[model samples]
Target: MSRSTLWLLFAVLAVAARPAAAAFPADANPDPRSISVSGSAEIKVPPDEVLLSVGVESRAIVLADAKRTNDADVAKALAFLRASGVADKDVQTDYVNIEPRYPYDSGAKVVARLQPEFYVVRKSIGVRLTRVGAYEEVLAGLLANGAQYVHGIEFRTSQLRKHRDAARALAIRAAQEKADALASELGVRRGPVRSVSESYSGGWWRGGSGGWGNVGGGQAMQNVIQQTGDGGNGEDGTLAVGQISVNATVSASFAIE
Candidate 1:
């Protein structure tokens, strides 16, 4: 009934009539229109250096004899490699194993007959080649010096990060382009970027027979010269027919406008 009370009620009614403003917790809020796309890229480059695994395996009746024979051959290999310009540090040992050889007689039976007939010891060395063409000569030299066990060889390049980035940039561009095209087709414009991701794979030579253990063995050495070269072998031991590839994937989400 009072003017002051009526005025206060009118003010309250006016305030209540106003629309409620949207309210949400930070994480609960979401942008409605968004698009996610992924793209991939690949690049190929020649491998620069070569890695060779060489070793010596010897078998004898006594562990001492086996170890002595293996050590002698390993010394010869290291000396030959050093003389050929390979650094002592570069010729690192990968593994050394000494074990007893078991004898199995006729009928798949474990015959305990006689003393342990043989002891086997193997010593492996890893060689890094800056000059690819020198591989053949190195092989021959090692062989002539009684370095008999040969492991497989691998070709690789050191510029991995550079090549990977190049591919990744291309992939990101591709994803952006695709997103733009999709936006155009859907009659929408690209808004702010929401998220991004990537993937990668690769690093292996194309050819070679048998495992590293078989490479330097007498039977395996017969084909060392016969191994097919991807690229021509030069005097420096550079087998040029080297190619490596890297792939990059980019997954991005952009707001739809």
Candidate 2:
């Protein structure tokens, strides 16, 4: 070959044979300098509000009579609630039910027949009490206003968002600290946070208040026994308020440094 052509060919060969750039250190190990860890945090907050369940029940041989009586009784209860500072929005109708009371068949060897039965109607309302102590006065008012059927009282918190946010922040901080500690133990420095999560709604209701129910004109003692059996330890002659409960739980993950 000519000298110039040979020189050009040699330069081209050298350019293409540059050792493949060292193949980027194939099978390169990680820094081996960091560790990962998870952490959790929890916070408990006192309940800030209470829930009251109250209502009235009425019965009569005629369905219309029963409904009218119930309507009057409920109106009275609502009036009492309104006067007791329960806002229109806060007072909610929880339930209304109407059922028939049947008569026993007293005929022997007779054709099957059904008799028109009396009607029993019940209506209930849920009252949200911001101040727990207000339960006493509220109960008195409800009783004075002809509240016949008081169902139950539940307690809860109104400032749920505040507690939840605080818990979450704490959880994140705890997780970051854990990650840092793990990294320190492994002789490495923390990098950047990769993820975080938390659960804030871990609360429960322990005990509650009590109220009354009217057993309209039947077996009073039997009715009272049945009611007590049904309500458990909540059998108070007048009204009782329940305690509120709030709980928060959080879990967080941070990148290992």
Candidate 3:
């Protein structure tokens, strides 16, 4: 090869071997020093509303007979509820099911392909009571009027949004207080907030065999503070309308100075 051609090839090879430049310099923008903390708060208040799940189940050798019995019982229960001042909008049919019950063999296993012993028809209804005080009376009337199964009862607050907002505000303040306390111990001061995140949960608890239960959507988290209110009871003291808990958690990062 000629000297000029060899020089041109060398130049191409040198260019190909060179490292690429970075898009951003390493020291152009460094991450700020920050302190991360999490805080939570819980607010308890008397429930203003109650939700009840009631159902009726009937069985017979004929499907039509079982369905008829279930329908009549449900109608009676609904009529009783209406008479007790429950509004139409607050009452809804939750579900309806029809299944066959087969006879069990001597070995306790269900017999296959044999004639069904009986047909079962079940219907469930949801009732929302705006007046928390009338829970006992309404429940008794439901049972007397043919509501056979009590699936569950949930006590809740109508002002859930207001209480949740208040809880979130308290949680943020708690986070700020924690950051300040930590900074004071380290002989540093907390600066402007750099990042923030939050989560929340709400639920109810009963006094009997059943324990804590979730009423709606939300994940459980640690609570920093808890307060309990009066267990709302009726004049006869048959039912206890316990307070509901609204909880919130906040995670925040603040600059350290």
lDDT score of residue 209 within candidate 1: 34
In Å, residue 235's CA in model 1 sits off its true spot by: 4.3
List model 2 lDDT by residue over 1-257, tens digit each: 89999999999998888887565586674444434455555554444566667667788999999999999988888888888888898888778889888766776333333444689888777888776556556766776686754455555556667766776676667767877777787777788655444565543342222433433321111111111211122333443333332334445444444
Instruction: Encode model 3's per-residue lDDT on 1-257: one tens digit a residue.
Output: 99999999999998878765555577876468899999999998888887877667889999999999999999999999999999999999888889998887766544363768899887777899989788878877887897766666677788888898999999999999999999999999999999999998885543221211331221121111124447555557445565778999999999999
Tell me the spans in candidate 3 whose CA falls farther than 4 Å from its real position.
1-28, 106-112, 203-231
TM-score of each: 0.73, 0.61, 0.78
Candidate 3 lDDT score at position 210 = 23
Q: Order the numbered candidates by TM-score, best leading.
A: 3, 1, 2
Per-residue lDDT of 2-110 in model 1, one digit per residue for the tens?
Answer: 9999999999998888765534456576777899999999887666666777667788888898898888988888888989998877778888887786766665445
Candidate 3, residue 197: the lDDT equals: 98
TM-score of 1: 0.73
- Model 1: clashing residue pairs? 132-237, 132-238, 133-236, 133-237, 133-238, 134-236, 134-237, 149-216, 150-216, 231-241
